[model samples]
Target: MIGWRLSGALVASGVLLALWWLWGANARLSDDLAAERAARLAAERSAVLARRVAEDEARAQLQGERLNVELKRAAIGRSDPVPDYLLDHLRGLGVVQ
Candidate 1:
């Protein structure tokens, strides 16, 4: 009778050990899957941010060029003859008084 009980106990312990090993393997697989998903998401987010930054830089460059062109046009329009600054002209206008 004691020999039969010892055999039963050994069988139960073997089954428990197998279950523990399976559980550990499953947990490791789940962790690996989660880590892979996180990496994929991070890569996608980085790609989108890089593209947006490139687009923003291009837009800023275009705006700068437009502003430069406008400034050049304004300067050209203001390129007229200079006013006379003689003392006689100031005296006639009563500015020297």
Candidate 2:
């Protein structure tokens, strides 16, 4: 009878210890999942910002090119014949009919 009681106590203690370890592992995994989610959100935000910056740069470059074409046109007015290079540039910009 005493031996049976001792064995029962040992089994119960082992089960309790296993439960405690499982709880700790679950908490650690939850923390890791939360950290991964945060990192993904941060990366998404950075990608959006990078795309905006690239778009702005492209817009600025296009505006600069258009301004240069206008200056070239003004420098050689209606009285002068348009140079072949300038005509090609205007055609490339879809400005020449």
**On residues 1-97, what C-alpha lDDT tens digit does candidate 2 reach at each position?**
9999999999999999999999999999999999999999999999999999999989977886875676577667834556779778867976554
TM-score between candidate 2 and the true structure: 0.59
Question: Candidate 1 at residue 12, lDDT?
Answer: 97
Instruction: Summing lDDT over every window of 10 consecutive residues in candidate 2, give the lowest-scoring window.
Output: 74-83
After superposition, which runs of candidate 2 have C-alpha atoms over 4 Å from their true positions?
73-97
Clash count in backbone of candidate 1: 0
Residue 78's lDDT within candidate 1 is 54
Evaluate all candidate structures by whole-model CA lDDT and list the values in order: 0.76, 0.84
Model 1 segments beyond 4 Å from truth? 78-97
List TM-scores for all candidates, in order: 0.71, 0.59
Top candidate, metric lDDT:
2
Top candidate, metric TM-score = 1
